[model samples]
Target: MANFHVYAAGTGSDVQHPTIRRIGVSDVLDALRLGFEDFWDKPSHYVFLGLIYPIVGVVLITWTSGGNALQLIYPLMTGFALLGPIAAIGLYEISRRRELNLDTSWWHALEVRNSPAMPAIVVVGIMLMALFVVWIVTAHTLYARVYDDAVPLSIGAFVSDVLTTQRGWTLIILGNLIGLLFALIALSTTVVAFPLLLDRDIGAYAAIETSARAIMANPVPMLFWGLIVAVALLIGSLPLLVGLAIVLPVLGHATWHLYRKVIEPAPAPVPVKAARSRKRSN
Candidate 1:
């Protein structure tokens, strides 16, 4: 077996991005199918990782259940998707290893720490984290504006107000529009970035540029893919967020497959000659 630490380290040159391909709707569906297969084949391997989503969801919801912060619950749930690429890093690693017929043990996911692109990955992750934070703050501000700093005494009351009031409708419209912008930014930048990094040593800029290029090349398909993700996340969130344990793993695995479909194979490495030994001076 390949060393865990070296798994998913891209063999391509750090300066060059792999060629990008134009993928179609069929390709996206196939990627999801393959991703689901990966998840099904070794469901137990991902149980630990899958559970993290709902656990974090519950924690965030609980944390926001107090004070005026309760208004943040919806934003927090939606904002969770913004941080998904980072959260799914391990799933990417698992899928990569499975593609190579390597051991797909859950622990191997941690091997991402030793990847050649770890630094670049960290940079992108930090970018996503910043976006999430910005989204939370924006959502909170918007809620405060709609309600004039009034606190919802209970979840039921919040739901009723949001469903019945004009201000609530305004919040929904504006929030969805702003959230769409954020989602587009995340999708365009990260659709292939984390996977590309895991597969290659290319720097953050190149991986991100390649992802943007992929989006540009296949705008319709990319938009459809984004919609699919949004819908799946919404459904997964309905059951007290517990369904995310299954939904997230499937999406995470599929994202890796999507990257495979969008980016062409890395170019073959050029052979290098060994240096000649110098004879000792007489």
Candidate 2:
């Protein structure tokens, strides 16, 4: 197992090697612009490729008749679970590699969705599912307890009823607090970890720790990035969840680039020589 370490910004640590570039808002925006340019450079290709999963996700969530929370959960998780970063990973790698004038095929990025990286992807998928479960259970549990007499129907009714009750308010506040904490922890690493694993062929633990170190070193920028993602997600939740079709893919590709920016790839190790050579005589 590879040893991983986290460091504060300006810590002068080996992991915080000079090769890793710290980024800011402008850097992120520039990357997005470049990604968009790459996407549009071959508009029909990306549109055809990108639209499949997101469209299905939007349709399922929009038409599902259930609690809004549950409705959102089923489709989003389904899309993520099936695709599991396979769709946009190639686009992301291509975009990054293009910057270096390296020619790459879309299949090259898709290839990361193979054996070794699969477990890391699964871990992330499970974490997302756990978060979703917490959200649904808490939201519905509070709704049930608070609105038993009223029998709230719509999402708006459930939210209104919950806000009006002490216990409900407590649950909402606590849930948000807990969610924020998890979000912070996740944001600190998820941006770089997955791509690092794919790009470096490193194990999940090393990738995660390296990602965490990158975030710790650049806390302010990472916080801003997290805020941007959160706001984008909230906005995407609007338009009856249709906006997610655009937002999710854009962010997914952008995150792959972000990982490339922060986590310096470890150098290939030199092999050790044998102490002595044996000779055979006949």
Candidate 3:
């Protein structure tokens, strides 16, 4: 069974906050470079996970197009940012293993299930999922308020309305402004939390606090990092979202490197008997 004790204080070890580092734009760039290297080293390892996004993208687009919920399609695509951290957990594991020179085969990505922090990871993932749901509901409400229960009849009509009308401009401006808030929240909280949890046994609370502290300590660099992520994802989303096949894994691996940059390495464990022997000799 997965260990749930990571959430309980002093369950196995004392819960202490990990040290947060103040990284700069250089560090962020280095992380991305290293991430790309990781992806290049074994592109085949990430193929399955990468293809999943395109498939899901196609399905969601079809669902919205068929159901006359065109307003929701954009929201759904943007909402992927909020859930991206959770989806990339497996990528983090693969990167972690490679960092240690361990086996990083495709199946090894699933090895995270045996991690001590799995339960904590699950909790944080659920939090992100809940946030996604809220964004969708809020988007729906925004559309309803502006359009008043009138669903766009077709893709061409929806595009024309969204592009040519005053209400369309209002929807565009307000939706983007609101979407920025949600994206910021996701970035602030999860920028390093998932990878940190996978790397160490820190509880979810400590992981989140440390991630927030990392951002607070280096807001400019972190914000720049967030911008890089948004732009990369946006580009990946073009061409039928197929580009994400390469973009997601690269970003995912890079995120692991980013966490390494932001968090200090865990301290080495002291030898218990050596302490007692030294005390007695003294």
Tens digits of per-residue lDDT for model 2, 1-282: 122322211223333232456777776776566556666555554555566655766655555445445423422432233233444565666666666777654554565566355565556545655755565555455445544534446766556655687865765676566557656756665567666655654455555567677787778777777777777766765675556556655766677766666666567654443222222221
- For all predicted structures, in order, the TM-scores are 0.91, 0.67, 0.95
Off by over 4 Å in 1: 1-15, 273-282
Q: Clash pairs of candidate 2?
A: none
Instruction: Please give the lDDT score at residue 5 for candidate 3.
Output: 64
The best candidate by TM-score is 3
RMSD after CA superposition, every candidate: 5.5, 7.7, 1.9
Q: What TM-score would candidate 1 get against the native?
A: 0.91
lDDT, residue 272, candidate 2:
43
lDDT at 240, model 1: 97
Q: Taking the tens digit of each residue's C-alpha lDDT, what string does model 1 give over 1-282? A: 222122233454345657878889999999999999999988987867988999999999989885457889999999999988898999999999999999999999999998877878888899999999999999888988888878889989998889898998999999999999999999999999999988987778888888899999999999999998999999999999988999899999999999999999987765443222222231
Order of candidate numbers by lDDT, starting with the best: 3, 1, 2
Error of 2 at 80 (Å): 8.4
Worst 10 residues of 3 by lDDT: 1-10
Per-residue error for 52 in candidate 2, Å, reads 5.1
lDDT of each: 0.88, 0.57, 0.88
lDDT of 3 by residue, 133-209 (tens): 99999999999999996978888898899999999999999999999999988888888989998888788877777
- Over 4 Å off, model 3: 1-3, 6-9, 12-14, 278-282
